[model samples]
Target chain A: MTDNKYAFFIGCLIPYRELAYEISARRIAKKLGIKLITMPDANCCGLPIDPVNHEMSIALAARNLCIAEDMGLNIITLCNGCFATLTKTNKQLKKDRELRQRVNKYLADISLEFKGSIEVKHFIEILAEDVGIEKLSELVTKPFNDLKVAEHYGCHFLRPHKYLETENPENPTVLTKLIELTGATVVDYLDESECCGGTVLGIDPNIPLSLARDKLKNIKEAGAEAIITICPNCHMIYDLNQPRIEKTFSETYGLPVLHYPQLLGLAMGITPEELALDELRVKADKVLSRLVEEIKVKH
Target chain B: MSNEVKTYRKPLRIDPEFKNLVLKMPGGETLKICFQCGTCTSSCPIAQIIDTYRPNQLMRLAQFGLKDKVLSSKTIWLCAACATCVDRCPQGVEMASVLRVLKNLAVKEGCVPRVFKDFGSAILKTGFVYNIPKTRTKKREDAGLPPLSKTKIEDIKKLAEKTGFIDTIKGEESDDRQ
Candidate 1:
């Protein structure tokens, strides 16, 4: 907990819907020599607060940060929602001394304190920082081998202006870099950061479908092999809703959607099954089979 | 001679187009500092897929009184939540999170689209989403996969709801259901 390894905060989204995102992430991080230390009693990021328990949500997110702080470790998260919640809440406690006192007072009984010492980093940030890109590049047992990948930055990662992440918030190149390490190519999509329509799609399926259609059209026009993503929410929309979007828009979008971790797992030479190939809605049969066989050949 | 002064530019009552609920996350929201910069638009990937969807423009619209317009726009529903626009925006308008606030707002307002009704039913009736469509089950049986029964689907939905998953969208994860 003394900052040597990270306290893994597997946000709600991945566990509930985006399972592969976390599974592949765990597998890849293990391979990279970074240990994802987990907290047994980790609570919500309190992102669901503001709308529910405003004060309690603030305290809940702070509690998670404090749990990491107590262990003397930095909290690392994969989902953008978790990242925003943990980071912003931590930022809040630090900026407002009064709020910090109240939050600490609330947690006094739970034996947690927030002296603004705990650090929160996104999974991508840890990959870039702890596991040097150079080393990640070296471990490319299986290069993507010219696979065309379109990088998708989900809303939580890119928006709200304040989450100036470890990775370049704008013109992010790390996900692309990870893909490139596998000897694959990254394609530029005009709407890479555009909202996959957020949970708005949950209420009005049409809105997200059109947005996905717009995303697919650009990806298709770009002649990409797959759409790669990092956020679970974004991944959910793209993976679950893409087929419906295709039917509605009258466009044939067969592009397979991938989580960032899956792409890294492939480059690390893991088998397709290990990366949870079944999770992808638009199956990457060629992409998966080719990567698997290529890894076997290379090794 | 006294001249009467006339002003067509009325005092800015709430411009719904420009009306966005600024979520001041105890961190003094820097998102409000954005000044119509298009750096985010130039870099957004989803922007190319769906024309008329721009993070920067959406941010600007939220500033106007276009609450309904912003919430119901095809753009908000489609944001993939990639940090690309936030990364590219010169003004630091994390329009991404701003849109999330709008999304949460949509849920609160219950202003969901009809197709989106599927999500509501999924939430109210089942905690988990039904992936295999009824029409597609027959096709799956043709592929040698076992047929998905209506009873099995209902059971799954019942279990998810029982587990309080449906409540998660009523905006919850706790047993309290508050």
Candidate 2:
């Protein structure tokens, strides 16, 4: 009855590498009075080979979307790649009669159909629009005002650019604003919109890593206390591979990265243990613990 | 057409942006062999759509260390991730994927030219990732769309889990923030 029940589209990354993010999302949603439903049968948003296989990607995203339509529910997704790919495909299929006809022809064999009932959304927009930042502010029990953070937006999530209208894609601040609402200072960095070289990692890793090195260097140089990410793939390279990248370069750029969910959860007073901030590949170690102590001491 | 030919300087140099972008590919080390044999030029759909690129020139910049030129070239943005060029390359370079990597670089560099954000957000709300149906798409036939395979949230979640898709999804929320 409009009472905040959201279907949590965990996608792929958090359950495995960034499980902390999932924990954070759930905990934060609970605090905000919005229920995140982790439904069964939620398969891939079918974003595999999205850059290459349009039809295949659409079909896969469609399959996911179709299920939600069947449920008569609105979906709130966590990954920008899945969010962008699924929504873009649906919009294209819906608006372009010809493309839709072709996609539908492919779908008929699989028994899947595109019903626009499913509204693909980034958690930020929903949080901003549906949940509202004002409400978010109300939920903030402890803001980490001492922390300095940089926001990184992955390519699939926002670059092709006209789809996710929550902010100006070029200089987006949705995450920064959300973080700011938590009383933290948004750190500035020249390479904030930099790529994580995600697509290249699966195929030829060197090219991707080399690309990632550029941004990692910038975030480190920016003196950011932490780097916040919105996509799982981006987190993997930046959060998990930063060590490997530094090793390859014969240097060290030890920076802690957090998913938006985790950051929000932390600020909302969710305990570090409950949010599982300790589970990341890069390890929160001194980062969160120290931040927590600082807060506790200040209080 | 004949009169305009006179205004064309012997040959307008290749887009400066493409030149540099070619050098920026993470390990885009082999980008130099492409001499615009007119083969890629003849095959590109983007070139057909927009007259701003020549695959040959773009290939040339890859070899010359023109990183910014290549990255900023409209050519990189125009690419639709089609594998035709990769298939056509005599050097066996995975051009499509390479360009995609470059495009990803471009996006990171602030090249979200248009329509990418809205489309992404739309899919997040509904599982479809797009405007498959406006409200409650109960009947596929109603929208002249194909009936979809009935999938459960768990099925998609598993697929996402198998692919480590959660990181990708959550990252989007974090990355796109202001």
lDDT of candidate 2 over A1-299, digit per residue (tens): 23476555666544435555655666666676777665445555756444422344556666666666776666777777677767777677667787667656665655667767656677777777788888788877667756777788775666445444445555776777787887767778864655565644433466457766777777778878778887877888887888888889887777888888887877777777777676576776545653443443232
What TM-score fits each model?
0.68, 0.63
Which residue ranges in model 1 land beyond 4 Å of their true spot? A1-4, A51-54, A109-111, A292-299, B1-178
Report how closely model 1 matches the true complex, as a DockQ value: 0.12
Per-residue error for B61 in candidate 2, Å, reads 13
| Candidate 1: residue A75 Cα off by (Å) | 1.4
For each candidate, the DockQ is 0.12, 0.05
Give the Cα error of residue A209 in candidate 1, in Å: 2.4
* Tens-digit lDDT track of model 1 for B69-141: 5554545655655556666666666665676666555545454334333443542332223343444444334
Q: Write the per-residue lDDT of candidate 1 for residues A147-247, one digit (tens) a residue.
A: 88788876666455554444445566767776677677888876565577664444345666777777888888998878888888778878877777777
Clash count, candidate 2: 122
Worst 10 residues of 1 chain B by lDDT: B1-10
Give the per-residue lDDT of model 2 (tens digit) for B1-178: 1222244455434444554554454324446555545666565544553455566665555455455555555555445433345545667555654565565555545554334443333334433334444332343243232233333444334333433333333333212211
